[model samples]
Target: MVTHYGRAVLHATRHGFRVERPLQNPQALLRVAVGIVLGTVVGYVLDQQMLCVGAWLAGLGSMIPHQRHRLGVSAASAVLLCVVGPVVGVYVHDVTWLLYVLAFLGVFAGGMLMMFGIGLGMRAIIMTILMVALADLAPDVPTGLTVVKWLALGGALGWICQLLPPHGPRFATQRKAVAALYDALAADVRAAAEGGTAPQPWPGPLLAARQTLTVLPQFSRAAAASLFGLVGEAERIARNVRVLQTAEGAVPEIYRAQAAAVAGALSDVASAVRSGRPNAVTADWSSGALSRTRSGEAHENRVRDLVDALTEAGRLVDVPDAGKAADSWQHTELTLLHSQPGFVARGLRRLREELTWSSPVLQHALRLAVAATIAEAVGRATGDWGGLGEPGHAFWLFLTAAIVLFPTFEHTFSRGISRSTGAIVGGLIGWALTLLPDARALHYLVLIALLFLYLAFRSTGQPLMIMWITAWVSYLGAGGSSAWTRTADTVIGSAIAMALYLLWPTWQSKSLPRLLASWVRVEGQRLGALAAAWADPSTADPIALDRMGHEARAARHKFDEAATHAESEPVHHLARWTGPELRLLSRSVHEVAKCSAMLTAHLPGPRLPGVPDAARYAEPLHLVMSELATAAETGAQPDPGLTSGLRDIFGAELADTLPAWQPGPDVFGRVTHSVEELASAMHGQEAPEHRIRSARREAH
Candidate 1:
């Protein structure tokens, strides 16, 4: 019979074996391969194998996916490895006991630094641990210093290679991301015009574009601002298309041709943005379509406004002097200026906030620290027993534990399985390769080939990548005995990591309620902003609206990520909502976001009549959502009448002013229905409508 712990391990193991398709990036492959090759060649020429190893590891560390900061990360990684690794190596050679203490502190510090960001934190841990491992491998102080010189040489070469490829203009990645968003929007518009089922809300590209643009250097502020404006226009167009789709029969059959033309134009805009070319908006379909429709009709007005938006977007894309246009846009400049706090100050503030015991970063750091220390002690003890060949072999044990123990149970568990399996397989491969080559030239060729394959298939999944890494390291160390020893160390280290997680698991369920609550609060803010825009379009700040949209999208992404991880968990005692309840609530929140987007899409122009009581009606809805958020957070029941009161007020307010053809009443109704469902779910009951629908199905 399986024990409770056994069953939990089995469950997590199943999730661990899942694999993702590999991504192919030729530029990245070229950059990493060239750096490694150059480092290895220099090390061989100098007759220092460990120096080549340092170069290989440093090059690997610099292989971050973000092009914008890849150069900076590469340079930093080189410096950290060359300087810190040598210093640690030379000192630890004399004071053997000092190794364990530094191991614990380095791992803990690296984990804690993750509170700032993943990139910074991971680099710190990798550099620190690798340096200690390298120092352990050194036979003497003189050898250690020589290795440091090699490291510096290798690192410098890697940094210089990154500068070799000018991928394109400064904001190329940002442009590509924004262009992809437009492509998605165009596809959505075409689908909506065909009366197909409304596309599911996919905010990924939009969020990516926003994030990429936000990180651009201040020197390209003007160009970045233009890209930001394009991102905003893409969002607005998507929202309008969603609004048109939701209003059943809003786009009459006669106007479908015009809608198709508009979609084609959007495609052209995407192409223009991607290629950095001007797109002359030559389409007259909007004017011709307007001429055929009656003036002031709801559908006609929507088409006209959409056309005007398309025209403006085309003009923005074609602007010859983007900097001049960006200068004239005072609001975007002000937003950028306001956000320019010193980097050090911003980092410190974030660090302070994450220093608490409740922070996930701190919790993960503690777990990693404790685990690494334990691995180091156990490795040394095993070495004393002669179970491992040497004390230096403990580096494998320490390295495995450091990399495998991640923040969440799912990742840590999965990585442990992958790392173990790959290490075992890779060790066998390395041992087999040793049987074929007694010659030094043959050995170097095999090593270089293995390195190239490793970098190329790095994206395939951890198991494959780790296998290649293990093989290369085994080959570098030179012998079947060493390979076997490394494999054994890896398996033991993986077991330790798994045991630590089982004993002190950071279950995603524990954070689900907080994430869900945060999402609800963000949606409430987005609705309030939409209401304000509708009340007075002239006063609406596009930058503020864009910011709110970005926040809502980010919050939704967080909740979704937590929900996904929580599903694989063996226990849900800490979760406030059941799996089905979480799914229903997530869907309801998504609907609420879509409705808000639709309302924003139909916001009147400056000269048009405004919704007189838009804010007054929205106030109650916002308060109700806030209360629901609070209830989710506190695990308390919300007011039973909160959603009902929202519906009553919203319905009454929109009934007098909004036309029958308008989506305002429909959007409000959908929002209220979703809110009511959330309230019912919180109270541990099926929503009234959900129950009624179930009964109808049963009767049928």
Candidate 2:
């Protein structure tokens, strides 16, 4: 795949072409059909149109799996929507200015809240509008109550569907993500073992498997913990692979067999993850030179340990080790997330930080509110002018605007094209369905087909998704006539969304500098935390250090995203030019991360003379980071003087300390060298070919 930078790489796609998603969850279609059919039947038996809305809502629910932790939240959101929709529906008929005020307030508030978390963002926004619009159909208090009950019934049925399925979209993503990581790791190991060269840094597909844990509440605590353990193990294996590659020259010929065995095992694990089968391959630690070599004991041991880690990783993937891994991993999560003593205070502080004017969250929330308000005003104006007899004629327009106007320009603009085209296709299909004989039976059958197609293409193709959903909405709203209006509303809303984004775009080009600076600063802070921990193990909170490391990782991810976007921007000359430098900086951060991970796993390693005082290392690193951040902000090369000074300090320290250090890999020295290259790259200088090769070896 030719990937461009951003949330998703926008390949040069042919207009009007549809690409189906390689959807893994085959049962998803059946679940949706069952949920919708069961809900519709119940509504019909109850003799309530509101029940039909509930049934449709239930079908929507079946699309997402609700876990134990999220069940309450989902239920609450559902009930809130059901209750609020009917009240909004009745009042929308009122001519008073209060109605408009209420509409704006409700929508604006919801839009802002959606910006706060990924979980709530699009899902909450769409569902909230759906409930409100449906409630407006019959604006009486009794009708509202009926809608609520039916909606609740439908939601319950969807939750039930979740309970019935083990193989789900989220889990599949997690599996594929893990499998991809292993593939990268295995390939890197193979390349180094065969080529006798440093491997490239592993490109992307970086631990997104963790996303499944965050997004899917249906994942049990044990399952989440086990997956977390597997991910952690994968990280460790990658580090060890790098270590082996670094010591590749010292490896005796005998170690090749072991390396080969490890590679095969890694491939097996990847295959197992992809196929959801057992990982039967195991690493052969005994074959390594560690057992026979007397001179290169350190190198052999490093290779031996690499093989062992790989073996454990294979076991974890196949057997889970749920009892110990789950418990330990759970504790790690809690410690990382809730390390501060006062939870409420920390939460408040974080919220305040996020709500600041300069914060991305606040900026996005404000943008969304502005866009939604404009959409609503335009929709209302069109409805009044068009004088379409139907009371909610313009509601679809508001929905389209809200749905398509994502936070980023890239997302919003892409969605506009996809959604507009999808709406037309769905509209045509809906119209065609109405023309067929026995329209009622055909409508139900067509609805099922649309629902199935929507589930299949949900994550892959935007155009098809839009079409299926619009078609589904048309059948539910007015059987067939509503389809034409749906398409028109979508086109108008998409135009407005695109225009809004273009007018006040959040260009990645402009954000890259700040993002890069922030990333460096966070990494600096993480380094400081590690230094503090090393200085006083008694005072060190392992969990807190882990949290800092996680934060640094997240910051690096953001920087990469910014770089990707910057690379694709029309006039982002600096971003385009600095691509190689950005990549080196990324590798440098990874090096720091590896150091942190190494330190965490193997503490009490020989601390040479100069390495004893953590402050000595920490203070210089901090200075370099400050200089790098400054250079990033000013768009200047980092000063060569600062780079040389750090290099001299590291060289002098290593020369004085290495002889006294116990016989093992010089991890501290390794870290210092990486930082030097990192600083060099920050100054707009290319890293030395040797350093680049070594880091690249690790990366691959």
TM-score for every candidate vs. truth?
A: 0.87, 0.78
What local distance difference test score does each model get?
0.72, 0.59
Q: Which candidate has the top score in lDDT?
A: 1
Residue runs of model 2 more than 4 Å from their true location after superposition: 1-22, 42-53, 62-117, 139-153, 163-235, 248-295, 303-349, 384-391, 475-481, 525-545, 571-617, 634-637, 659-700
Give one digit per residue, the lDDT tens place, for model 1 in 1-700: 2464466567667666666566466676787678777877776677656555666766766764443656776777778867775677677866767877777788888898765456666777776676667666778888777777777877787777778774544466677887788777777667766655335344867767766665565666665666767776676566656655665444476456656766787888787777676554556545654345444446556666567667667766667777777766544423643245544666678778888988887888888988877876777667633643545777777878888998777778788987899899999998888788487767777888888878876877777888888898788778777788788888898888878987987788888878878988988887877777676678887767767777888888878778877876667656777778777776666667777777767667677767767767657667788998999888888988777777775666665776444644766666666778778877767687767866996796
Give model 1 RMSD, 1 decimal: 4.0
Judge candidate 1 at residue 340 and give its lDDT: 55
Tens-digit per-residue lDDT, 437-490, candidate 2: 765555556665666677677767678878888887776555455776777878
lDDT of 1: 0.72
